[model samples]
Target: MKARAVARVLGKHVVMIVLMMFWLSVLVFCLSRMAPGDPLQSFYGDAVQSMSTGELEAARHRLGLDAPLWVQYEKWLSGVAQGDFGMSLKYKRPALEVAGPLIGNTLILGGAAYALVFALAIGMALICVRYEDSWIDRTLCAAGTVAFYTPAFWLGTMLVLVFSVNLHWLPGSGAYRPGMAGDVADRMRHLVLPLVVMVASHVWYYACMIRNRLLDEVRRDYVLLARSKGLGRRRVLMRHCLRNVLPGIVSLMAISVPHVLSGTYVAETVFNYPGIGLLSVSSAKYHDYNMLMLMVMLAGFLVIVSSILAQAVNEIIDSRMKGAERGGV
Candidate 1:
């Protein structure tokens, strides 16, 4: 019976993801087709301008762009169903092939930043909770608000100018120094500025949420009881309040995936980092339909999956949610 319930839950989530992806694909396809730009420019570069009308038609036919919009969508959908994403018009390569390494780079950058942002947020929240209404908490709150509102591009540019251009302390762009690709330390040095921008832009938002939650937890009856039992303030906060609040924190992190991912993309573009974020910008600018379609689909899928997984985790962690799910089932 338990196994059956788990299977049912899994099946429901799979169906939800499939439906979401289908609609997302439809939306992306229609929008990309309707957007202004000559895809031929992406494919043929400056030569597209020199092509005669007849030659241009021939080129379009060769690339299957001469087909009607619905017909093209049908062809593209069928190809996607079979795990073929088609060729990238700009690179003249298989879309996945071109994006594969970049995806790994993005995962590395994004994954690290995601983990660090949460860690720092939680740590800062703890410090604020410890200090409560003291000057430290007030100072952090002010700094965080300013950092949260700072434009990521402007922050990135300033960091580059100061650290890379003036101090010569860190390399501003790219995933690694060209020949030092195998060195983890070299890669980390390149990661520093982008990571700083991502962390600075995101850490405070979550920190504030955590601080509020922790403060709320501190006032609960159980905390008062714990304090009455001669438990130290730090012990009660850590052992009781923090533990109780962790499940909500998990849910918050799951909800934050899309937000953090968007910040990652912005950081990537600013740094010229060879990641899916940079690829996304270039693909959109060049009207590389196949590449754009793949990136959009990948992003949408991740967002949907993360939300589903967060709900599942919530169900597992909170008995109230589990009971609710079972009753609904």
Candidate 2:
């Protein structure tokens, strides 16, 4: 019975993700088609000015731009099914090959930022929860508010001014110093400002969510019972309330994936980091529909996968809690 229930949940999430991907592809395809400027023209650059109408028509046909929007999307989607997202119009190479390195760069930058955000958020939450209703809690809450409201770009710019320009402490931009790309220390130094900005951009939301959820759990009957049974405050929080709050923290972590991706857009651009976000900026400037559409699809895929994982975490935690209750009874 439990196996059947698990299968049903997995089946539902798979169907939902498939439908979401389909609609997301359709929406992004239509929007890219409607956007201004021809990618071929962007690709050809000054040469576009000299191309004859027939030449332009041939180029359009070769690039599938001459087809009806639906036909174009159909061709693209078919390619995607075969692990090809079409070729980059600008680079004249497979989109996957061109985007491969950028994806890895994004993973590194986003992964680091994600780790820092969770660490700071959980640490702040624990501190605030321990000192609930005190001045420390109020101070942390205010700081969270500030971080939540501050634009990532502005914060990154200010950090650049202070640390890179004024203090000469870190490289102003790029993934690494031009000649020092092979140096681990140099690469890390270059990453610090952007990583800090990305973490700051997201820490507040998670911290607040965690703190609020934990506080709510503290007021629950289970927590009260634990405390009344002679458990110390810390013990009650750790043994009772904290476990109950894990699912909420997991949910917040899953939901924050997109926000972190968006923050990467700002952080990468501000720091001139050569990641998916920086690629996205350039793709937009060139109206590279193939690259842009692939990015949109990737984002949708991440959100769907994260959501499913979050649900799984919730189920696991809830089952454990139920098992604990049964054992206690």
Top-scoring candidate (TM-score): 1
TM-score against truth, every candidate: 0.96, 0.88
* Model 2: lDDT of residue 78: 88
| Model 1: per-residue Cα lDDT over 1-329, one tens digit each | 99998899889999999999999998999999899999999999999999999999999999999999889989999999998999999999999999998888899999999999999999999999988999999999999999999999999999999999999999999999878878999999999999999999999999999999999999999989888989999998888889989989999999899999999899999999999889999999999999999999989988999989888878777887678789999
Displacement of residue 245 (Cα, Å) in model 1 is: 0.4
Q: Which digits, one per residue and each the tens of the lDDT, describe model 2 over residues 1-329?
A: 99998799879989999999999889878987898887886678779889999999998888779999889988998899999998887777887888887787788889899989998998898889888989999999998899888988889899999999999999889887777768888878988999888877789888888888888878888778877888888887776677767777777787678888888878889999988888877877798888888777777898788877877777777898899999999
> Which 10-residue window of candidate 2 scores lowest in summed lDDT?
238-247
- What candidate 1 gets wrong by more than 4 Å, as runs, is 318-329
Whole-model lDDT values for every prediction: 0.94, 0.85
CA displacement after TM-score superposition, residue 88 of candidate 2 (Å) = 0.9
